[model samples]
Target chain A: MTIDARADRVTLAAVAAEARVSISTVSKVLNGRADVSEATRERVEGLLGRHGYRRRTSPSSAAPLIELVFHELDTIWAMELIRGVEDVAREASASVVLTESGTRHAPGPEWLEGVLQRRPLGVVLVFSSLPAGVKDQLRSRAIPFAVVDPAGDPDPDVPSVGSANWSGGLAATRHLLELGHRRIAMITGPEDMMCSLARLDGYRSAMSNAGHGVDPTLVRFGDFHVQGGHDIATELLALPADRRPTAIFAGSDLQALGVLEAARRQGLRVPEDLSVVGYDDVAVARWSSPALTTVHQPLRNMAQEAARLVLRAREGASVSTRMDLATSLVVRNSTARLVEPTEA
Target chain B: MTIDARADRVTLAAVAAEARVSISTVSKVLNGRADVSEATRERVEGLLGRHGYRRRTSPSSAAPLIELVFHELDTIWAMELIRGVEDVAREASASVVLTESGTRHAPGPEWLEGVLQRRPLGVVLVFSSLPAGVKDQLRSRAIPFAVVDPAGDPDPDVPSVGSANWSGGLAATRHLLELGHRRIAMITGPEDMMCSLARLDGYRSAMSNAGHGVDPTLVRFGDFHVQGGHDIATELLALPADRRPTAIFAGSDLQALGVLEAARRQGLRVPEDLSVVGYDDVAVARWSSPALTTVHQPLRNMAQEAARLVLRAREGASVSTRMDLATSLVVRNSTARLVEPTEA
Candidate 1:
């Protein structure tokens, strides 16, 4: 076993020479090109593996890297998405670079410039809208991108991943209705967002199906934050006793926490006086006092699927342009049977 | 006033020509160099600002970027750090690139390679250790770096930012003692971390000063996570009623939440049967049940200071090797006056 002085620094060219193949043939084999003969592929692969030869550090051969852009990284919801994407990225030997667009709706010009300079293999955006120019720019560069919970109705050509928001809303509302509650109030996310609209539609549909007309006065819009929920809830709870609702459906767990605070300030007891249902069963939901009953949005799974879809798009593989994972209702201690007014 | 043909695109050369300066002089202004005359500097700056002539897209003149590496991005604590760094980076016209080291102690080889290839202006690491070889590699490249809440005692030469852990721990312990809690338990972070050890030392010192010998059995080491706190708290709470501590001081707010859960499971009333004190007054602390009374470790301020320090170091400015921000105790509803066993 004589060792060549250059043995330590293995190269694709050396592997090609040892395998008695052209550099192109070796490259084809490494890339899983069907043109390479099975015998030739095996020989090249064996030599490459034995010599510890990795793909050359070229633009086309480098390990793929993906970028995840978020409006902000302050919430547990964002953390769940990051975890999901990282899980998929790790399995593919890919890297995830995180950036904040510095705006809620869309990234600014500076962010776009920075992203273009990085030239990532793909991009996954969370709660963001893509401007027409930005879309054209990404297309021009042949960079695949997918959105997780897009801010609005995404272009038909754009790929997106989200949960069944409409179904989640219906399930939550129906649960409250089954517990003998007619005066139910709803708090939804930003009205412009597709998910928010869909969830609101579901709530309306459920109410209609139950033979109860939707009361516009009982419905409020929130920014999907605790403070927003708290402010809106404070307004709702301040209604005269005869007009007050017995149950509230919050748009997010953070908002539901705000509702809880409002109820606490009014000296109202959860489940006993004011039943509550929250969306997005984030980790803290379980730790919340009385343990929130929420709709499980499968945020992590949505992110995982979005990552997979972008990777597939990058590989020129056919994938669905839109994906909606399932959402389910989680019954916890927050909701209980409503008592009659006469009982009080 | 005629618009130039290249008005849409501003160049450094145009700014130099307008200001009657050389290209190198304009470059010095953009890079914040000190050699240029004050009069020349003002004229060039005004022209650059008016024309919006950013530096040319060269390796040396490119926009500044800072890389923030975290062991994991799953915790609210990590989000707080990211928020702080982003706040400073935004003001400095610098972009933040986020990467997970993928290991608890240090980054893997691939992460290091990727970071070096990006050629960032500086680097900020959160709860990560830097190996000697890695440190040397960064130093050789003249890339400045700083750590936030470093895992252990970093090299004296390594710049770092942290909270005053000893004072925070001492204040928390002293508060519990003032409430007449003779038997108190402490839950600190991992044993090897400098911050954890410092906090533990503070607890010991407080106990010694109060003329009570520190009980070795009452101290437990946690991983600075909710589950770790839960498991350790469960064990501590399971002790015979006569032997169990009347109060528990947690190293972090997440741990305090777990302690609350453990007490809840044991049918113990917080601040009545058990008093709890937590560190790191993260946002969630105010939302937790009983609104946790904890020491406020200025995590965001620490991060902001670290970012500022790295930026200064990159400019070839002298800076302190280590910086510690102040921590204070925030009294809330989680703690109360301890009642005697006879009263109970």
Candidate 2:
């Protein structure tokens, strides 16, 4: 990661001259200082980007740091992602700076300033896409960035890492089908997310491939949390004995836990009375009373890939713009073979 | 927050003169630059500590950063602590820098260098104690530090936050006793950990207070994880039916899940055939099949207090040297009144 290797790199002075601004003004704009006017900042940034101007690094200024930004860090999946970044950072002898900027972060002018000042080697964002303004800011400073998108959505212009959500849903549903379950219910994430739609389509495809028609009544949208699973399962379980599904496939592990709770409330035995399958084989999936038969999303590996991508890009290495890792089903004790109704 | 406000602060130049070194050498030592010799560095640091030298902060050098060092981040309790620090950092417009230096940090010589370079506002250590060398390094630079120790044992010299582990254990056992459970079993953490010993003592006290003798054969120590709970419970449940316990108290929520699985495998229904109580009411407690009756150890709050203490100390405010948060019992569906054996 030396500066002079790229013989074609543009000079800061050239960018300043092209923008018709002083070197100091260009520097201020590069550092994300608010002193420069918005128009002037944008023009300087455009010139810097077009010229492919990479900032010169001083021994003192090149801090061993990797910045990680998330929409929210309270989710169960966040820990796995953090551990992944930490793994890479540790090997590189770098420390990770963590920030939780909500989705409403407008191009992250507020958060972007901190990154610019810190001048981290690279950034790993836990979002589906980076805003245009934010992308420009990072590019101008030569601070490479990549997104770790769990939603299976990515911006065409941004480098991103995601899991095979469609495949995960397909495998989860197929496990129940193999268990001889005909009445299987599916609870997916919010309908608006691309990952949710992809997963739902996979579930439909699995049912279709099994020589069975999709039961519209057995499909429901969930919020991907425990409460969503609980609420959806509560009503689904309350249906008539003949109509109630003997198996349920949940969108996430948290949701699967909710389904289990609902089953326990009604005196139903897991794997015996009601089989349940979960997505995202997180810690709780295995720790749940009846370990969930679920799909592994490879969250940690995805995060590691994103961080590695950003670091390599920062070091002037060409890398993949998009990488989708595989997901697979893990059969635990939560699912069982379907049995006939003994009461009848 | 300002340099002039602290009239009693020692000067760097004075320390340099007293240590027979140039001001530049002191500067290098403060920056953690490796150019300085170890002998000179130690002498200069000793003089700085003795004289109480406080580094003058320039506006640009004051990074809005908080350093959090953990022995390991893989523990289940880490996420909550991270969130607590993030809460304070967000409110104060500071970002958290995380490092996972194992317990063998050796006063964090490798980690301390990075922290000194970052010049964060303050630091929160998750370990029970900081090595003398590490403590001296932070102090010479006037970097305030605090510990958020879950292990109960904490260094008296360090400002720390711990929970009422003894109370948690007592409450859990008492809950079982109140439910008419006489043949109760207890699973504490590793014997070497202060928390484990404290909790064990609490259980002993609770049983004695209720005029009941604790059955020696019914007690066991666990690793505070799911596997530990399961392995221990399996053997306990396998004891002769006449000597088998009617209730069990687990060391942690993860352990409680293991116990639940053990009960299921043995065809024993919880809260009916066997009541269970868990310590540390983490997320899994509520999500468990039969929601766990647990002791809530305010982990998040303890983290917040530790972070707050560090920040306040950094700003020259006097703060508590130690803070022990309270623990309370949460009655859920896992515990019930003991009923006579149906076989009898």
Candidate 3:
């Protein structure tokens, strides 16, 4: 069977001939107005590419399809980012192909190589930093890509869209400080990640601004998972009751949930004894047993904006345009008014 | 500017010449390998495709790529299914193209047309019944495809993989009976859907086997959405308190969540006053307040099976084979032991 690239493109006559029913049947197939036999409809479509027939493109494909790559973390966090990506992709009539950047811990060079090979319309890098060589490769390809909360300034040339993490960290810290909790501690993500550093910087800046010296003993780091949060929180709780920090700020919602579980296990009442704040207002944030008062990054909005940026870039926009959306603090039951020292 | 039909078969050398790049650079561009300059990669690819180079028959040509088409439902239901699809697709070193099957209430006849046009290596149709015509079209094109829980027979030629909804429904009803509840009602999905019918059949068979008469009034029609479940439950609650059925079997987890909310508005306590059993056991089911006693469908397994089926189908396997995965009852806090009439 000689592959006739043109034969797949369908013309009215070719469609009619293949359906083996009638010209009107083929017309009806294209128009979808009349009930041509399903058999005939399939046959006509098989000829479409051969005859070079172009069906009116749907709104979903408003822009060319781009692929979004992410490194897997928690189920909830992954879901939230995807939700944001979908919302943006849908409104823009662009489609996103979401793929695991391939490993649970760290995606290897091979993974990056595989993704770049697809020659996607564009690529959205989420929660993962671009390696030095990958950045060089992207620059050389002149591929229009955008970073969605990537680890660091992986590529200054490529635009990025993310929330102001330092501001979010400051807000979380300030909330805890206002509650009269002088002994506050924090749990953060991996050390090398830019997000962790930025969030940690925000915490330090907030503490310093509030006239308190940073206590190195009160800080710890872990992988961004519920167990990581729980383990860190447990270690903190095990500290002498008086030495334990009155408030804890977790870098992620998953970690916050873990903190909550740990607090519960230790029989500590929130607000009355311990207060916690989380980052990323994932859907579960609202539904968790003491609805968490956390930093609300517009994950969906970011995903949408990143998608728009990629599409715009693909349409030949400048590569240097970066979009940084704002983050807000959502107060919920997980936090409480800090009791005065006299009361304590 | 010429549209060349024969140009589709151009070799790498021709593409490089057109792009003014070396053949090695063209190969790197197509392979997504690092070290290539971006400018050279883009120019080479454009020239290759502009000249219509048929992708060479290489390892990359057989690279697994699966297309996922959802039934255009709310995010709540689609989330888990997509996750399941992603999990299996990633394991197989394949990529997923996410698309919707048009509007649920107003699906166009061309729904399948868009999918066929892409010429994806394999297609996974989720919660959709391939109209007889769509199946025939797939068969004639010999495109490898699999339907997830299709409502109709797949032309006796295509493989299908889905959770055992019938068994799931039966388990749900049996659990309610085992709890000593005599008068139980069901809220089912749309009549046209196979899941709805199969689940309802399970309820009927279980009730009959237990020597309980199936009351038509006790069952109400609903879509799988929360509002649909809530609406039906609300109507049932409107009946005199004593006349209301003691428990409700919701056809889906989303529907059950609504049933719980509806019961709460009427000041009813779960399991204590009105026991509820749900289907699908989605992620939310385990987290919802009071948690939910649900029938756990093997969505992940089914997704894996579907992916496997697509692989086989693409390799030209006959359709006589299919897979039906088993499900289990996940008993949780939402259900209670039926109170004795004398005690009440």
Candidate 4:
């Protein structure tokens, strides 16, 4: 139970002594050597974590590769993040090792074994947090890692990069309000994600700051996809003339497109009748007809920062990092000045 | 100079003798060891290519990593290809090594050196062809590779996977013509790319089969980008009412988006005033406001096929392959029957 003294001076001897194993066995586990028995490896790893035994760095341990692991490389944002990491790695004369580690919060133990063997320069994970076992193994092997948490949740002890979700939401709503729209609706992402709550809070603050009370029926929690946007917008547009919002802030670009589809189906002309704003100014935002007026979610820059941070961490710099890059409003063709009276 | 008989039985000793070096030096160069002098490495590589010396496969040489190289990881198609490679590699319990080889058609000597040192299971290049020197280095080291050429051009001797561009074009144009569109404009990709030319030729064939003459003014060679599509579409839309085409078969999804923008700018309603058909049904096609009617270029399947082919080659199978997966049409809101007479 006396953890503080052991945490300060964590050597292989101390870890092996506590685990009741030889130093060579602990070293075998550290190096991810195959001959070590499973039971012995687990016991050594537990002691190493408990003792905070940081692996001493060596020249051969840092290979000329940056590991980029994702739960799922979904849609446009994945490509942007990949490009960002690839750019930084190329600049440092290193290649990228891409991994889709199943649809989960963290990769499995099999992936950990490979990483321990590869001993990459650094790792950039596109997730909010890592499993304790994975984190301990990475630390014991001296592999630095940083998370690119676009979903806005970050573990306090880990280094991470994220976009300013609250600011993005505020800017998106302000853009619509400036267009002379008094009644505005907001569709944020899934309820579980911290990003959704942050965006919703931003929307509420914007409405209250403008001296307007937000109508409960005008707010919705969407799945951050096209179908969700379409479904929610359809219900909103079907409201009575005085109750329907004249403008909508779709939290993501995909949702904005869905809103556009719903508006088209209802024979409502965009900008002319109902203005729309989107977040996550992805490539689709620019390509959509009447290019979206949205918020730019600095995703590529976030990934780039994550890569740089991990690299910096490997160089023995500050690892206690939680940096949120700024997001900005992109005014395109989607929003327009209100020509009709909005007295909702 | 006598490559005929030497091609049948090539060994390190033969290559070393031909290059005027020791067999150990040849072995060092073959293993991508940095100890060999540049002059000796080049000479050994030249002799290896000339004699067609293929290294015998070994267990250690085939690492559990698939190298995926690209010149530029642009907008969206790159992600699809990455997913395909990732899927196949995951099924094979292998990881993917992603490399951005500059904006050139092939990676440089530095990249090739790293690849040789890694000695991966296989390489999947997203290029039309490889340099003779790079190809020789791969073959001499017994590293299997296959190209995923979205461009229609393919190297005759090398294995590659491509979609049926000509067929894609034929399908897109036929779909538009079947909708009672007579004056159909065809905006294909770059004039130099074989895919662009093949697609244009298919359009021509479709027109001829429909008992119509191909109009020179109605066809344009574009850069297969958004700006090119928008610019070309703007010009086409500005033509005299009688000369303007009612339907346009935009060669790629990006171009189709451009076409949509141009139509929007011109205040013309899609499917009502102008019908648009896009090639390469990327995800953007579905997200577009009036989802594009497009040719489904099986880019993901093509990449999967390339990975599978290279993996099979690694297992001592045939490497001489050229595959063109079929392309089909995806009908959406962009194309519709012409309400007015299209006798232009």
Candidate 5:
């Protein structure tokens, strides 16, 4: 894509003239640095109105370079995903920009159009569920892009690269089963997300394959956040002691941490009293109190693949769009063999 | 900026035709996507070579609309920093494009030039330490940008925002001192970095104010990483018992984790035998075993302020420069009072 040379159409002189203030004051107000008086800031803002010196809107050759878009940044899951995207973009000889969709706090479309108009060689969507219309728009514009851990049913046509969530779920559950856990409960991410659904399905299939019926009551839905895990675990704890499951499986590491906290608050010791397992062995998992047992997604590999996908799409590849990588379970101290409950 | 109305530019189709491949495959190669057999990909490369279709390097009316430029995204510090920048940019009514200077891995003028040429309205330097000459180049362009936690004594003229590191360090050290620990040691960040220096200054000043001579041997330098903390702590543990400080202060949360691991490997009980305090109380701090007693920098707040600075700078605010926000200490179980040798 060509750069828009005249992007910086709005000049400081224009803003200063419109604002009726010294250029320095206006600049200070803009920068929010100390030294600008309140009255001057307001006056400058008014002048900005009269002069119509809006920040550059349309992508010009002068506009900033490509941006890396994230659905949410607070979650630990996004950390590795982001690092992966950055690593690949760095190697590809491209500059990286960052933005978040805020699916967790609120859902809306703001950055998508701006990103589309920029005509970046490609974009990386981190663990985001792109709206159907937005996806169609990208397709029509032929904007090369890729999504990591897309949260929905797999669409055979869209190019995506991520780990096998379903298989990861199965691996997590199977590990518990192998250690003699018969009654296993699960905490899953939001229903709309593909990874969450796949993981839940994995849990179910593993139980079924082991000749056991999945208990609907034992499964709880969470928002894939720490608080969600805490809330779900608290709900699980409210059940009578006799009905409590022998093991708990969390969909994400943050959720597993919440589970640990919930168990701790209830005076239950990890592994000794309650066996817990988590997904996404983030850096925190290794140092947590019990050193969580988890399933590790090939984060770096997925990021590299996603970057490659977007770059390829930008280069023009009319091919099937989907990638499902594998996951491996790590045996940590969080899980132990099932022990028969002593009769009170 | 007004949208350039220029139409008839050479499209991907033209390049594909020149390369003698489907338009899709050419798109893939240019965008850097994978899937075409190596032979076809190489052939496409040769075709682009034979036919001088230089991929639209010149500036034109229709500039790429958005860009995402980052200082570096390879480090965990940079990754979180980008997340916040990305989140705010999406909400600020503009699309983003991603770019990086890769300053840590490759610090050169050529790298800086590529980013500036993109001409984004604003750029977010993710925990950047821009070389002196590069800053001048950016200033000459009058490009509006923001830096996060700049490395050394930040220039007062540039508009950047970050948590108050001096206060953060002071708070961390104060907490350890208040816990009745007299002999405290420190593991600091990169020596040249302003934040590291400020933190060290805070640590020293705190001890001096409390009638303690700053022991030079008790202090160590690390690169603000996990292994750095681990290595330093291991070395500290090898010292004679009387020489080893009873309490330790680590510069960053990542490094603190390494220190924790070292303590564990040495069979040192947290609080009972030793105390630790860390800075930049990242999210992981809360869940870490013994829960890191550290200082918290409002990362989200710092990010939001930086975005505001850039937006204001874009609005013709000539008065732009550095910003220093405040920080607080978060007390946890990682630290305890100092006990006499015979007390136990």
Candidate 6:
């Protein structure tokens, strides 16, 4: 892993040229020289910090570092994304630095400022949005950044990588419909997120295509967490037996697990009494009891693409700004044909 | 989220004093001035980089950064640790920078050098070993670091925080013994890890106390992964009926899931045909089929303590070098009373 020595040299030279002073003058500011005028000292210091210029004593070193920002770092889903990004970073001989945005969508100004001082070669925002101010700051610093599964439809100029959530949701719902489930329910992520809306739209399309008009009452919005799934599933399951849905399409595998837990509490066996289909075939999906039948969204591939795009951009290459990976259905034991009611 | 401004001022002042030159001369060297003598320039430059002298233009800023190093970033277990550290960091107004060591026990020299250049307030290493050379470098630079679940017993001077693994293992095995499981099997982590050895020792002690000598063939060493548990359990289940164990204790919840998978493939019902116990009652333990009866290691608490220890050390406070949090048994559905065989 060789450090980007050329980048350091370029930054030092640029700082010197920008300040219209000898390289030594900028170095003096870094060393806290009192001889330089206060105005000149401040200007050189600003450029030095902004460009992250440091003394390059060694030539061969670790690869350039890339910053990966996450809204939160508690879920296994984030782990999958981290694994994917690390895979690409390793191949590129780069290191990855992970930081939580300390908020749900936009990073705080303080976080952005620290990032600027560190001067990562590029940045990858996972399930996060780039605030306009941050975008401007990064652009001004000449730092490349890309988004992975942006929470909203990103601006056209912002590069991003995501999966076909609409298609995945459609396939998941279609799987349940083909299993002879009519009174089916859908549990989706936060209603405000674009991906969540896309998935819900897909579910609606599949139901309507199958001649079953959309039932708004049967759709519940969740926070893409287990508790969210559990709470909603509990309410749905508590409905009158005759009106209860025989199948469920959970937005994520974690939610699917929660649904399975709800079924267990209600004394209903999976597949036999209630069929479930999930999204994002994370590792735990295979280990899940009865195994999860889910839409296989390539989380790792999406992360890799995000990392690749940012690295490419850093290299001054012209690359597509948007990438949507394919999603497929994985048949497993979680879904089955709904048994017809026996004659009384 | 105030930055450690005092530390930055002290570093610059210390460098100037140590160089035995006017502060302006040191500044000239920092600015890359050609007029400075080569000998003076070399001495000042070395001190500047080593001390991490950065200009402090802001009085109030984001908290100092802390680095958290992991051997790999693939497991939910790692995520739990991250969450714990992040909790403490957030309270301290510190931001965490996460990095993967790319190796199992030791972070490479290049990675360490980069970390030094970043000049983090402190470092928390999860499941990693500190090489003597690296330790010396960190000490010489006055950077404080603490280990969380160190790969091995660390030097007395090195602070660390870990769980009571032996007690947890003993409690888990005792729970199975109390349920009349005489022929019990143990699936532990790698033989090289100190925690693994402690767990295996606890298992052995329990068996001996019960007057049941351990069967060497029933003990398996794994890598603390799902497949490790699965493969070992498969081999154990393949034995002749009379030789098969009635209960098994897996070192981790992930391994227990594999054991469950193995039992399922063999058409055995949990707690009826085979009782099992697992360690590390992670979130998945509650949602596993029949739920998992395991030991709770307080992983999050352990992480919080590690972060706290490093921070306390950074504040020039004297503290204990080692901490072992308590672990307890969490009885769930995976274990039950063994049914006596009826005479044919």
Docking class of 6: acceptable
DockQ of each: 0.21, 0.78, 0.14, 0.79, 0.23, 0.31
First chain TM-score, candidate 4? 0.93
* Candidate 4 stretches greater than 4 Å from native: A1-25, A341-344, B1-10, B13-25, B341-344
Q: Order of all candidates by DockQ, from best down to worst?
A: 4, 2, 6, 5, 1, 3
Native contact recovery (fnat) for each candidate is: 0.28, 0.84, 0.26, 0.88, 0.43, 0.38
lDDT of 6: 0.78
Please tell me which model should have the higher DockQ, number 5 or number 6.
6
Instruction: Let me know the TM-score candidate 5 reaches against the reference structure.
Output: 0.70
DockQ, candidate no. 5: 0.23
lDDT of 4 by residue, A1-344 (tens): 24643543347788888888888888888877778889999888888888778876753557789999999987568988999999899988899999999867998777777788778998999989888778778987779999999998998878999988898888888777777787899999999999999998989888888888899999999999998899999999999998998999998999999999999889888878899999998888888888999999988898899999988888878765799999999999889998774333
Per-model TM against the reference: 0.74, 0.93, 0.65, 0.94, 0.70, 0.76
Q: List the residue pairs that clash in candidate 6.
A: A24-B31, A27-B30, A27-B31, A28-B31
| Candidate 6 C-alpha lDDT tens digits along B87-193 | 88778756777778778777876566556566667788885457775665566445678888734365577788887888878898899999988889999988978
* Model 3 residue A138 distance off true place after TM-score fit, in angstroms: 3.4
Report the lDDT tens digits of candidate 6 across residue range A112-193: 6556556667788875456665676566556778998734466677888888889888999998999888889999999878
Full-model lDDT for every candidate: 0.79, 0.87, 0.70, 0.88, 0.68, 0.78
CA lDDT of A176 in candidate 2? 85
Task: State the lDDT of candidate 3 residue by residue for A28-75, as single tens digits.
Answer: 544433355656655765665456564332233232356777776235
Could you tell me the lDDT of residue B13 within candidate 3?
76
Top-lDDT structure, candidate number: 4
Selected candidate, larger lDDT, 2 vs 5: 2
Q: Name the 10 consecutive residues with the lowest summed lDDT in model 5 chain A.
A: A56-65
